[model samples]
Target chain A: MQENFIKATAFAALLSASAAVGLTGAAQADSIKIGINVPQTGFAAADGTSALIGAQLAAEQANANGGVNGKNVELVVYDDQASPKSAVPIATKLVEQDEVKIAISGSYSGATRAAAGVFQEAGVPYISAFAVHPEITRSGDYVFRTSFVGEVQGRAGAKLIGESLGKKKVTLITLKNDFGQSLANGFKEAAEQFGIEIISEYEYSIKDRQFGPIVAKVKSDAPDAIYASGYFFTAGPLVSQLRSGGIDVPVIGQEGYDSQKFIEIAGGASEGVIITTSLDRDSDSPEAKDFIAAFEEKAGYKADMVAASGHTAMKVAIAALREAGSEDPKAIRDAIAGLTLEASTGTISFNGLGEVRKDVQVQVVKDGNWHRHSIISDPDLLAPPEK
Target chain B: MLAFELLLQGLVQGSIYALIAVGLTLVYGLLRILHVAHAGLFTLGGYIGVIVTNATGSLLLALLVAMPAMGLLGIGIYRTCYQPLLSRPPYVALIASIGLFIMMEELFRLIFGPYGLSFTAPPLQDTVAVFGVNLKEAELATMIGAVVLIGGLALLTLRTRIGTASRATVTDPKMAEAFGVNIGRIRDINFFVGSALAAAAGVMVALLNNLVEPTMGSVPSYKALAIIVLGGLGDLRGTLIAALALGVIEAYGTIYLGNLLDRDAIAFAFLIAVLMLRPQGLFGRA
Candidate 1:
């Protein structure tokens, strides 16, 4: 009994020491570790690394300016592999094992959805950067994103097409996954509201390469424009096949087309295409400029919106952490819901579930590049365009 | 316009199905092992071809490197993962193959990064218009390459000594072994040949689409399984015919459904019906 008591006492001592280390061990703590969960490899590998680089640059810049509460931030990353099945274990490791209080993630909506549940259960705050699924915010208070839901992007895209570009006959070519489908559905509702006739709609598999038949049928519909909202893998070929078929209609897409490689794949054909996205690298916002410059210098490549979103998510979480002055999940969640930061993207403020409520911006693909096309109307806009 | 475009596109996709299925059928004919790992190898080929193109900036060089690399990797994988399990339950090797597929895919993810690699098909981006229907130069190339690969596989099986030995081994492994034929060597060669063809198919896909990902092989791999079942597992002639049929059917299905219905469902559903009707496969040795 004495031996058992001694062992228990030793274990308690160790626990106290670890807590001391976990909390106030700043001098010896090396840095405040925040887990960066994204798909660093797999289908989302490219954007995953881009997001990681943003987190890395943010942590670096934060340290350069003397980190949060004098504790340098450390980013310990785990690759969610862009698969829902893979995200659970990685989130488990981050929350239960690594014990990081805050994480930024979500390369694929499905993966983000899978990880969000794990984080909420574990009382760890997770910020999704590029995953814009509307359902993700419903995961709970602990889950948040720098990017708004697809509903926003979709409605904005439909508005831009209906009100701005003046095209009525439309067709949607979307990835059939829930994330892509949700956006398509959102666009469909909005387009109908705008009195647009979506002559036809098509959904492709996530890995489908040949878009020959899909594009051909859309051409038959003779829609004034097409909306393809999958990533470069599927979208590139879709555009290529469209061009080959002489369907030369103006193609507008979602955030998936924001990557540099998208243009690289679509090349000459991608010119004059437009896509709705969170923030363009060429944003006139000073914060956006600074972040882009630092990111470009660090990664030795142009920064994508996904990377910018991740850095912005960290900024949101870190700001909330400071406001709460504690690592408690509930406190942080409340602080995030009330966050108001002039971030690189825009003024980020969240609704009840901690998802940012922001305007959706439409960007045009011109000269084989994505450039701001229009400021998508919000209630805050000079005037919300006529309904 | 949509139907016409869908037809040409479906033909291109169908061609790819043919390329992938032929190799799968070949392996089943000789080894009697349904290698799920071939998909991993197929995906590996795409990524490898991308890397080769990036580093060397030569499409030809990328093909040269990825093809032989996949072939050699196939032989090595068979020796390490399958050879020992050959004597064990047949299902054992298949399960091991699934594990190996996971491991190889994870390793690929580690090495290749998750985002797909893009190959610039500047030359082939040009299209040829026939009967007011658009056909991409890349798709045409893909079909041509598929034909060549299938033709070569057929010729190799008919003419070569190793091919004859493989035939003998396929007819009766025990008799071939007693006749002093090196069954192990034949298996290794067969695996290498199958994997090499899959790599070639990968190159075609990458070239045709200008994109490749580690998980890219999964869809084609599953399609190959569907085709094998439909064609009669061990029957080469039926596999080819099934590939074309699947390709055309999927293309039309995508169009008829107005793009909402995924064409893969058609292949999968057909596979289920076939399994119910013919447990031994449509064209497998009766």
Candidate 2:
């Protein structure tokens, strides 16, 4: 019994020694660490990869200008795999293990939503690069979003679908998730304002690639337009299926559909698909031109809306850090809440809800490329409706 | 007219389901290995098919090359992962298969990137009118290919020597071995044929959908699992029939009910309902 007790004590001592070494190893104060939680695999991996590129560019630019009060910014990235279950642990690792003052989520809404509570509980400032779910920012004051809320994008989409395109009767196909449901709700609420009648609303699983029955229903109903609320993967096949099934109504989507991959997947069926996004690729602004040139050169491809949002979010985080002139999370959060800067997407300023009120670009697919259609600058349209 | 169109749509979907599930059933019936990695093979087949199609500009060539390649891969998988685990518990082999599935998905993601890839063949993009209903060319190809392959498999099992040996081994392995049948060789051949069927399903699905991604195998694979179970695990004819029924039900349900349950959920719901009434599945022997 005495030998067993001694063994237990020795084991306990070893564990303590190891843990101390680990904690000391992680708490090094060499550079400012900004935790990056992005989906490197799974459904949203493409967007995550693009967002990573944009974040890296932001870090490079900041470092070139001498990062945040003479201390270089170090981006510590982790793959949340676009899953909420994965995001929780990743958030804990970023805050407690990596000792980061702030975290940037470049993943989809699900992951960002999952990590927000953790960051808030830990009192670490959290910023979502492109996730647009309104509830993300509403999680707590510590959480902020560089992208506009889904409700804002959906309202703009409804206006474009109803008043601008003059399609009064519509069929809605939603993705059956938080992002899709919220967007659909926003569109449904505002759809009546412009005399647009929603003939039918069909929800589908994200895993669904077959749209035969859905297409048949759309054909029989024969609405003036079809608004699909999903990401580019679903939108691509949904458009292809609809067109191939010979139901060629105007198809409209939100920012999730704004990617070159969508056009490629749709294979000419993407023509005339109107989408509301945050970035205008053809903007003539000198700042836009310069940002685009620099981004393309660094990224080795054209920057999409998500990539621009990521770059903008990183810039905002850095700006907050600089303005605070300290590494305190509370100070950084305060600086971010009051930040106002011109971004590649537009002028970024946070509302009371910590959601960015920025320009939303409207684009259309024509001749297999995204062409600028119009810009919705109305603040009333951009603001999230009172809860 | 709408009902008729829905029936045809069901048949198209059912054909693809059967194409995928049949191989899974075959492997499970003879080996009792579960073969969860079958879905990964299907996705690999899609990648190979697309690569070949782009390189040769012939969908036919893609189909031919992808099947053989996947068949060879199946043999390699059996040799490397399964053969050593044969002496261990069956669940050990299942765990290995799950590991393989994850690795294959990661490899495909690394090779193809995370975006959805277009698998369009220009000649197959045109839609054809079938009984006054518009159907994509790939759908027609899928139906025809499924029929030929399933029919051929049925015939081979009914009228071939290897088929008889395979049945013998599955029924009583020790007895079959006593009668001079090499059970190991039979298992290898079955794995090859099963994996080839999964690959074929992958190619057809990619063609019909006009897009393929690394994670494409996961959903269909889960559906395939439900299919194998609901069709009375390891029952060949039962799996085929259940697959068709599932397709028709999913079609009509999605149309009339309007996404009250997701199409995949509808399938599981059907499986549960059927299992409640008949626990041995539709065709499991007493």
Candidate 3:
């Protein structure tokens, strides 16, 4: 018994010694560690991969340009599997173990929101790359977002449909999730102001691929347009089925349908379908053009909005680190709150609530690719909540 | 016109369910195991169909390759995973089946990449007007394929020597062995037919959606399990009817009670009602 006790004590001592060494090692290293939480597996793996590549490209570019304050920018990535259960543990590890200067979430809303709470509690500055849940920034002052919240995008969709497209009658096909519910809520809130009449609202689960009943009902309603919210996997089937069911109204979607895979899955039915998203593929801005070319070349596939958002988040973090001129977490957070820069997605600026304030970019499927439809630049209409 | 369209949509959806659940029922009838890995076979068949169709641009050729390949894989699974645990409690085999299903999903993701694959040139995009209701050609093909395949299966099981042997084994494997019926061969044939049907369902769904995803089998897997239970567990004819009935009910419920419940929730609610009213299922012999 005494020998076993001695052995246990020795093991505990060795563990503490190693942990101390690890801390010193991290402090001495000439690198600014940025924690990245992304969904490298599960249903959202595709978007996660794009986001990871985008962040990596930004880091590469920063290091190539003499690094951030002469310290190389290093990303420590963890796969959250797009689950809140996974994100909590990952965020804790990033804060307590890695002691990263800042953390970025390149995952969905649920996972990002979960991670945001952990980072906020630890007083580590956190930025959401593309996850659009409003609750994320509500976590704390340390939490910020680099993308449009679902409500902002949805409100833009209402404007695009009612005022821009000159369509007054609308039907809403909502996916029953945080992403969908928020988008639907925003669209409904702004619909009346745009003189749009909501004919009907239908809700479906994320798992549903067959929208036969919804399509039939929508056809009967025969609205001037349809506003639907779903990712590419669900959107593709929904659009195809609606078209095949002989409902040829313009289908408006949000960032969920922003992938090229949506077009490929929907086939010819994708033509004329519009969405409110971040990345403007037809942008003439040098930042957008350079980022697009670099991202596509590095990723070995077409750059997506998620990728651009991830890149933008990393660029923001680097800029903050440079502005602070030190590795202090509190200083980094203050710098991030005050920093403004041009990114591939848009002009990046944070509101009082850490929510981004930028013009929503609208794109439409034409000639088998997403092209710029119009830009919504109404400051009063697009303003994010301060508190 | 709306009613007709809903009915047509339900029938098409039901046909796909029948194609999927028939295989699950067959395996359960013979082995008394849930055979959850059957869903994995369906996903594998979908991947096979997508790969072959993309390479050859022929849906027929894709079907031909996927069916036989999945049949052989089904047999292999039985030989390696099920045969060892068959003598033990049925739960042992069930646990192994679930593990295999999860492993297969991961394998698919690792091999095919996490993103879903779409057919380069999916056929039957144009609609056909049937009774003043527009139906896609793919939907028509799905209904017809289910009819032909299920009909062929009915003939095979009702009027053949192998069918008699298979039925004998399902009733009592020891008795069938005593009567000189090759029970092992019957088991092999049972798995072969079941897996082949699952492959057909997979390819049909892939074509219908024009999307093949790794987790596509997940929803169908549990749904098929529920269907078999709703059909009184291993009653083939009852399983077929239950699948079609569930499809129709879901279509109607989706429109009527959709605001109150999701499409899947509506399905389970109907299932619960049916189970409470008739514990032996709609067509099961009580």
Candidate 4:
């Protein structure tokens, strides 16, 4: 009697499992699956949450307007924790198990670059939202980036400081990481062309909140401007220390400092600080303006570059899905490569290497908020690598 | 002028290190167990300080509330996590402490959110010029606080009955127990005082950086471990000197060797060299 009962339970479980699979199969017929990998529970969780919200908002808006080819867009999300090891399995699961048509990475360079290889190997088109590592796009033609590469942004920073701000003597404070190294390289390469002289360069780790040594050295050097590479966590303390040290010169940062939290952390010292980024808080473009409004309403905070990048990636994906007229991975890849759509971040287009091609936006802190400073649109200087 | 400024900066940084490492050294002197979770207590103190300060708009009240709260928590940790494991090998307790630290960090992340919290109105944004060196008010506060608290601790240990009891317990717990020195109570006191010092350091660091996050204690945790070892394990005075020396060395090395290595790498390289030359530590009574 007990054996019969156990057999009956097993048969019920098998029947339910098949029914669940059948339900999913039926749902999959009218929906386009897009996988998203983000660092939801790690050091980059704040940015990851913002990026996820931005992507979700984009999907919601797309569905409201009628999804690609009359099919609802479904996002299969996973937490990468900003680690390469976590991202690899996530990428594989998204591609193999879920059979997602495409994937977007709203994570740091390490995780994004690692996942890019898996997506490439699986022949599934992948888009990196904001990771700036140069190697990410090098993964394959199947991978694309919707944000400025570190080198391009770094070059833009050089131009912003050297020409726009007219600061010839500069001190470079490089964060010891891929993001910082790439930016420093681009800044150095363009510094000479822009007639800027780099007197000294100092490197610090991401864990360092204290910038006493660098501040003292930079104060002694007394450069006309300082170009530093760091995210808000590091930049906030570094800038505060620099200002409190009485070395008040123009500090140029990259997209990493493009968050309101930087202002809060730096306090009054954030005033006059500038950064080269994609999102312009004072942008007059309707697309950017609408995105800012919608995102603020949805996320309940001021939109940052990461959020804008995530939103832009999703919009590009939806646009590509529509352009391809089907869910074929190759067709989606071709459409993405050929498409040029104005996004919340900026005008989005891909180069031969799947790197983004667009002018860099410069924003400065004024009255505790980011405002437009200028635009670095030098085509020759800002042109990304084609291959 | 640059040298003077760097020196002041180093002293300020060193004072914070001393405050943090003193607690770890005291705990080791009493229990012979590495208190890796002390770093977690430091992080918790910072979170409590920030939350309180933001709510009360008074830094003093924040510090007052955080110290006792953390002191109690430290005692609780000793009773629950360390007490049971104390019977086993030292490595077992050390491993448990490390696990506790990681768990505390994750708990902080889950409770406070991944992004760090900033003081609503951080004090010491103004600079005061002294001897041609501009010092931040926050730095000055940290230095002064460290000196007073550490000095008070020194007096208490040297002049008070509890100090004698603690030293007795440290020297020979079994003998001290026979001599009517409550060894368990002394251990509790050791953890309470040590954790309170960590709390002070945590709050000061949060003020100094104007940002507090879950992983803020990680660097200081390992650095304190390196420092206690460098200063001779269980030696408070040695830890103090080692902490200051490290801060100054880091200040100088960052400018000189920064291009060659990272700030943390520079610190560890110095540690490795020191350990190789003197395995007993800088002041470990060789």
Candidate 5:
């Protein structure tokens, strides 16, 4: 009865505050701020925007449902522009001034690492939404990511292209950045395991607006599949030019091209492109079905890997908050490390390195939509599934 | 077969670089200003071309719309920013133009964000088999367009009255005024011509690469700067020849260096060595 009186008094105060205001009221004043960063204006902006929109939609929906223990959640948005040069300053500003106790972000691996330094120095826990580099998870104590690293995705990716597709010969064309290099290395390592031969390995710069020479080389090699580990900027033109060059084969890629820009660039011609990504919305799990329905309803668009990663990161963070029974950074960090949340995408429990347990999904870009299929380990794809 | 394909691939990529580099050379040659904003102007042209292409699904319309739009912008920049500072110190104009570059870059970013806009390649997907070599649709068409444009510009400079006037004024501004030439008019027209050439290259790049970003021109700009210097500053024929050579070098370099070397560094090292040996440039008069 004494606890009930205290709760009743708090409710009465919140109601009185709502009554006295026209625009500013209980909702605005009682909001818990969460810092959000992404490349809102650079090469990776499309993916960043999609992830941000999905996360924003989730935040809004959660707020509608009385938010994080009945306190409204406010997202403090900042544009990192996908630069380490810019991300450091933004992270500093968010931490020092806005005082957001928790943050969820990252697009480029480099930018994430740069911000991770600041967050670690300040002892703030950050849940990275989509940085795939292994170095990011290794930076410091406060850094954790819901997305799988490029190494895991890379090895899994190569296996999917080589073994699942029954491809014997392949061509490797990728950007020479860390993100691209890591995937190439993973694929190379996995190739020996699967007994696949790489016919040609062509490297291109992110600034190189031409892929003709590389595609031409790939064509002459006559590989069964062309594996490109780059974003839409390079892959879109490379595949189109390859087809135009009269060399048509299946082109497999990593998770970088998972954006509407890919479809927009590839157009109807992107039929045979296969890419490896995780957290597919069309996954058969009941939680995945609920997430897909809810995400589509809230975002008015389909969920992809980045969105799935964001959902997982948020759930992990919030679950940690609940387990700790306090919103402090130390409590949240311990809580997150010990969290075993059943996210819509999959069950996630981080190891010491702060990566989700190893499991990946392979998706094919066919008829202009991401079609998810059975996991790579399923031996059925090699033969035929009984319809 | 692979070697032949790689070289041909290099030439095609080099052709686009040459086209844009020559445009930068033109603006630099006529205006004696670095015009750091040249790349931004090219990006704007690309944006205009993209919108036109998407709406009409016509390549020619996109090029036509983008060309004039970029020309008008060039004229505006000249009259507003570069013209008023004509009497001030060269350093003042340099600073002002730099500021203009920042403003233009931010404006494009505000409207178009940082993501590259996807542009569908036009109806030139038909392949031409030459001596059993399969040439790409858009690449061959672009090379043809670049050559024709370069030839036309060269003819205009040598044969036209305004072209002669521009040359005469740059050589001796006071003498050209005394000879009854409208120097300002010639400068304005040169800006239009130069900017149009850049915008044309911009549209072609979008078609070739199938993507356009506001900052795309920076790479071509540095390359053009190197080409201009290597070919002989203020030497159009030299710029053209040097651009082709740079393209071949880049292809070989990428093949060898594995795209790990800085493009500017490679172009600079070769150009600088050439400059140290011949101070006036390959085509520049001593």
Candidate 6:
């Protein structure tokens, strides 16, 4: 009886304290709350930090333009550390405690996929900035992806390798995970369509620092080119090791290789390495020019593909909020599902699954910078099926 | 040619493992503490080495600065974390060291902004051919530096007065203290040297991989722990042999078997087999 009395007293005090705090919060909360989940640490820290900067830039631009529905836009960011375990709690805090109306994810596929379920159950619209896994948008109606899916980019890569570059024979070095395998699957499926023959395929763990043995295998295979799938950290060293091993054929990579740090780590070996990514920094489009200038001016470095996706995701969110004219998450989700805007990457429109349909830009590293080589556009790739 | 290249690659990676595992073994010999935070020191050395390299644009300067910096840090760690917990159980010290490791990683994240730093020296970019195998100047330097440093350490332990004092303390601290050996001072010197060796390995890794991250030391450090145990707790020579053998086995395993069981699988497999055969390690005293 005494323990129950103490518990009751403590609960009353907690209620009163929270009520006071809640009143204060309601009085001062003039800005519409948007949550951003990104990895600020771990293996993907470099990409995560750039994505954070891009999201911040978008929020700043929206505020400068008087924000959505004439209210200031505020972003509450949580670092998932690129792990699903960390992302789950951050998602809960964003919805249950922070009361954020919407969320934008700038993390890898694992964290984004994990957090999408949390936001969906809570009726919050979750926009993925750059995670390309197809399962991400398939989670729920509330889950949306502003970036192209992995299969789209992979298909584009195969088309570029076979049709444009005329590389008939290729050796694939996949990173052995969802992002790598999904991309590789798309590449394999479309390789035959473009008359490209996959000579050999090999897998490498993400934790691998040395590529000597793998490169040796590739050297012996001696295909026309090598298609490597991995992030900048692995991709950079892979290129360096491959070149140092005297295998100098054209090395094609996925969007994971699209970072300035890729050039930094690979050094001169990054030159002539081709990759297919969603964003083209050198594009003459007004959206590209404006975003590049603003992001670089703010971040002190050139924006990469992931960064552009962050900016577009936030812009799309704010636009949806403006059209909805309220803080209702379902209305915002509806507005976003119907959104058709010209984003930094390309024209942004969602299919039934909320995956973005856009052109993947083929870029090649030239003289320590990414130069636009060509673009592969597929109209039916992202279109929703006719009812 | 492929076999030859794999051997060279294994030797380089094994040399780094030898440097790291040897330090852990040395600390365990004297303190009886696992010293898990030693990995944090290795990571710190890598970060500091990168900073110094960028500032000075000299690989030599980076090594010179990083080694001493880590040595000083070792002394600091000993004074604060280890010394206070010395009177407690050895396991207490071990657990505290794990805490120190976590704290150091978090501190690094806070300071370095959680981004991986690229370490590059312009002069080290050139490739040198040795025995018909192409190697970057940085890779060759790492191999040569590891050999010279290990040899120098062996000589120091076998010949020098301080080395003898360290050995005396390690053998029997109470007896050495009773004989006026100042065991505490010997332990400090031991930590300084061991930490310096780890720092050298860290800088070499940053140079070779061209990337230095805050969490990079954790895995290598844990692997070093496995090496020390597989080498019979505190056996230096055994550690060296095990390190090299594991590196070669991993390289070959990744090539022959699929990458599904390449790195940790090969190391642990060799370890389990060795344990089944000779539980005291390759060169360990039974």
True contacts kept of 2: 0.62
Compute each candidate's TM-score over C-alphas: 0.89, 0.94, 0.95, 0.95, 0.89, 0.93
Q: After superposition, which runs of candidate 1 have C-alpha atoms over 4 Å from their true positions?
A: A1-33, A83-99, A118-124, A328-330, A380-387, B1-7, B51-65, B159-162, B258-261
After TM-score superposition, the amount by which residue A124's alpha carbon in candidate 3 deviates from its true location, in angstroms, is 0.8
Could you say which candidate leads in DockQ? 1
Residue A228 displacement (Å), model 6:
0.9
Which 10 residues in a row give candidate 6 chain A its minimum summed lDDT? A19-28
- Tens digit per residue, CA lDDT, model 2, B1-286: 6787788888899998998899889888887888888999999888888878878898889889999889889988888777877777788788777867876787688789888567654447789999899898888888999889989888888799999998898888999999999998988888888889889998888887777899999987789889988899999999999999999999999877655777778988888998899898988875
After superposition, candidate 4 runs with Cα above 4 Å error: A1-30
Global lDDT scores for all candidate models:
0.76, 0.85, 0.89, 0.89, 0.73, 0.84
True contacts kept of each: 0.69, 0.62, 0.72, 0.72, 0.58, 0.42
Model 6, A1-387: lDDT tens digits are 234335545765785476446433442268889998888766677788899889889989998998778788888877788899999999999999889999999999999999999999999999999997788887889999988777777778888889888999999998878889888988898899999999998887777767877777788889998889999888888898898888989999978998888998889889999999978877889998899889989999888988999999999999999988888888999999999988788888887888887777889999999989887777754332221
Off by over 4 Å in 6: A1-28, A380-387, B119-121
Q: What's the interface RMS deviation of candidate 1?
A: 9.1
User: DockQ values for all predictions?
Assistant: 0.45, 0.41, 0.40, 0.40, 0.30, 0.32
Deviating ranges (above 4 Å) for candidate 2: A1-30, A385-387, B120-123
Q: Model 4, B69: alpha-carbon shift in Å?
A: 1.0
TM-score between model 6 and native: 0.93
- Candidate 2 CA-lDDT value: 0.85
lDDT of 1 at A76: 67
Q: Report the C-alpha lDDT of model 5 over A1-387, residue by residue, as the tens digit.
A: 234334545765774455335212323676676777887665567677667776776676677776786677777777777789988987898799878778887468878888888888888888888787777767776888887667666777677777788887988887778888888877887787877898888787777667665666666678988888887766777777777777778888867777656766767557768787766646778767777677777766677667677776766666676577767899889888888877766766777766666356677776778777546543221211111
- Model 1, range A308-375, lDDT digits (tens) per residue? 88788878767777788776778877788778897777776776666676667677777867788877
Write the residue-wise lDDT of candidate 2 on A316-371 in tens digits: 89999999999989999999989998777888888777888787799899898888
